[model samples]
Target: MDVPEEHSYERVKYIPQNFFETICNDNPDDFETELKKVIFSHVDASEKLGQKSLEELIDYKSQVLLKDITLFQNEGGILNKDIIDLEKKRTATYRKSIEEGLSNKKLELANHQSNKPKDVAKLESNGDYQKSIDEEIKYKRAEKEKLEEELNLATKKKSEQKIKQSNLERISQAIDTFQSQYEKLKTDNEPFLKTIGFKFEDAVQVHIDKNAINTLVETVKIKIETLSDSIKPDNENGLAFKIIKLGEEITNLQSKLDEPTKRYQTYLDDISKWEQREQELIGAEDIELTLKYYEGVLIYLDNELENDLAYKREQRKGVVSQLHEKKRAILEVYKELYKPVTGFLEQYKNINKDYEITFDVSFRLKDFEEKFLNYVNQGVKGTFYGNKEGTVTLKQIILETDFNTLEGVIEFFDKIIICLERDRRPGQGNESREIQSQIKNGFYLDMYNLIFNLDYLVPYYELKLGGKSILQLSPGEKGALLLIFYLILDQDDIPLIIDQPEENLDNQSVYNILVPFIKHAKSNRQIIIVTHNPNIAVVCDAEQIIHVSISKTQDNEMSINSGAIENPSINSSIVQILEGTMPAFEKRELKYTLTKNNMHSIPV
Candidate 1:
């Protein structure tokens, strides 16, 4: 026992995995309500209770227990939001999933197929959600026409851009020819230009006017420096005349160049605009894919396109039907969820016979109706405008009705829900996605709990303590009950350290319940109780007793006196320390003669 090798452990914060708790609460504080923690907590670590299948029990409640409780509760009705929501999502989302490529047509069809109630007496008894397909067709056709018109405009723009580009190229050619002639004229007589005193920097000036060139050629420098300093002016056939001839030719080319130059720039700007608009219609990126995608969507939209979309839609319907059939087949033998509380209760009953506790889970239809309407009211509170007339009708119907059958209840709630809906934002119904991901896990089973469903249920749970409800029990009784359970069922070989267990219980109640239990418990394991009560210390037949005391003279010093009832000094100290305690034992002795025949042994 002293060797470290015999055991292993790791330190942990908060409650450990085994649920071995330090029972510190002096009073019974909602232990009945916290039955899950109580039973499953590995404090007692019972093999029988631990071995009980929580899964099996949960199944039993919703399946087997549901039948009895439903019929017993208020005839038959929906239990909580979870079971109803689960049924709707399963029926609406997964089972009747109708999907097509690149559209919400399938999802709409699926929603219509699954979530909607097919037949209620008030529902005009129309064919099951016929609007899903025909409405889709109408909407698609409208969209298809709009896109087609856009595509036609884009095609026309493409043609216009091509035509404009060609016209621009011709204008550009005229401008280019003028440029070539002008460049040739300059280069053909480069020496003449330099001699004419034109400041042709590294290259000719980018844009030159014939007038400017003419002004340069008439400079005094040009007249003086023409040929070997022969300064002259005013000759029609001389160097000045030759340079003037060059200017005249440039002026003629400039006249030809003027018309196309502005027009060429205008064409460039216009083509850029045209191409931008073209890119918008087709796409800047993914132009090929975009066109192909448009073609596919148009085909789906076109009634006369003569494609396999109908076949595909039909195939989807067939799949939905098959899934529906499978769901129905599964439902015949399976219940959605059964809380394992019933199974838990069965084990709890055996764990402690002294525990006079009983629990009942019931399904109430009236509660469901009230809850659903409350939900409706809350949903309508802030909405600016809605289907008020529809809501009024639904509320009235909900207010006036007691739905008898499960089908009737579901249909009624479905209608109410439809009326309560707002102009939903995108992703409004994504709860179905979340629920779908959780199926068949332990969480899925918890959804079907009759009494509760993870904030979703009003499944009724009735817990009774001592033939009266745990709720009806007084604080004292609750405290006493908590104390007894801790003392009785929690008995084990490890030292049971209790500080004044008698403090909460009345003295008589303590003697009756605790003493017998502690005596029986002590046979199996050690019981360490800190108490000031003399009746407990003497009557429990203690083999040894230790009295702890602080030394009066020395504050830091402490002393302990140890012995049984036979030890003199310990007896003297016990009398002095427990001064008033002797009178109660004296009265008890005087009231009844102390004989072996007078005493009766309590049953363990």
Candidate 2:
């Protein structure tokens, strides 16, 4: 819709159809698909509008898609039996083919059974011949040799036994002669044995002594009975009990010692296990502590450095402003200076007599005046000048002299920032410098702020990247700024909440900036952006949407209905905007519209 250039720009609005038609619209399925396509288009457009980035655009597009998809389904778009039947037919065909293939493979395998390898035959015939011939001959030969050696050794041992028997007979004769002497020797040795308390015939007398010992035993038994009669029963019983108790005490002590030995072994094993566990825990603890400390230090340094950098930025902004003012003053002074020359050139041109000379004078004076003015406007930066009739041209002035002063001023300001950063860095001797990280954190956050509030922020970040102070932002820069304002109004448990965050953003910035921001917000938070950008709504999660439809009732009165559908994900603010504008949007013919006609109006 083209409009008069002189008139303010207005976004087109969407109007819902009447209730009866909406509830009974023909081609409801097609409408849903078309609406889905529209939502995706919006998302695509949002993405290309880079100010908002992909994340934000996706969020907005998701919401729009959800609303349209849901509405389409709620209006009676359903799964068709024809499609289901077709799918089942395809599945059956696939299954039949697979079964046929399996059957053919089984038949082929059965036919190929004879091709299977049989076990390799062993040389049983060779084994039978070897066993019956060579093995039998070798065994008989070995047995005969073994028997021959044994027979020879037995014959030799028999001869040696006979020789030993002959020597024994000679010794027996010598022993007979010594027998008589033995008796006398024994008689002499008997007296000595008695003196030494040993008898030569004690071995023979042992049995005889045993009988005498038995007689003594009987005599001792009689004496024991007499002693028992003399002693008191009470004393004997007490002595016996004391002896038994002592024996039991000794036995209990021995058992107690063994228990300590077992416990000591168990204690040693436990200590060894505990020590191993302790080592493992200690190692883990060290790593965990190191990570925590490093992370903590990084966070602290980031905050501190950012604070300092922000202060430095403020200081630089003050300096940049002063420099700008100085530059402006210089320009103003140059303008005033050149104004006199311009007046002279015009006066001289009017007074010239000769046509050619007059033209030359006019041109020379104009060139000089223009050149001087250009130089003055550029803060007296030196420039080239073309001379003719004692005057220079503006174009010529710009090509000759290099204005080093302005460059020097710019370089000086840049150095000031560099010096500030260098000073903020930790001492060279110290290893804990986080100045660089802090600077990055500060820059990233600042960049985020600009992205969120593109109406003001985009240009701000651009300026910073361009080596300009934040305070020196132009009006255009402010226009491109974007901001993401997050407010946790309540911390209590709740299922979902919708917010109209785009109310603060501009229409042009909305697609590239606000929509993406909304989408980003919704990605992390369950939000519904009431946007006309169908692109954003289409890609959103389908389960979270609640579609609200507006239509005229049978009585010709406007009405609204809400329902669930295939896609349920939507930003609540978008829903609210649509719901609120339902009546008004009914009068309007478009299928979509912004909430308020006012350019900067936000939801209340």
Worst 10 residues of 2 by lDDT: 355-364
Per-residue CA lDDT of model 2 for 337-365, tens digit only, reads 23333343344332212210100100011
Query: What is the per-residue lDDT of model 1 for residues 1-604, given as tens digits with 9 covering 90 to 100?
Result: 6534544542211221112122223322334234434333332233323334433333433453443333333311233332344334333343233222223443434444454332322112134433343333335434544544554554455455455555555655656667886677567668766888774445555563355434443442333344312212355544334444544543343334334342442343345445544444444222433433444444434443223433433343333333333323323312222123334345555444554555444332334433333333232322212345434554565555433334444454444333333322233442222222323333333322321211122233344556665446554455545454554444234566656666556767666656665665667656666777756666667667787878778975889888897788767666665554567657666767645435655344
TM-score of model 2 (CA atoms): 0.16
Using TM-score as the measure, the top candidate is 1
Question: What TM-score would every model get versus the actual structure?
Answer: 0.32, 0.16
lDDT of 1: 0.43
Candidate 1: residue 51 lDDT (0-100): 38
User: Could you tell me how far off, in angstroms, the CA of residue 493 lies in candidate 2 after the best superposition?
Assistant: 12
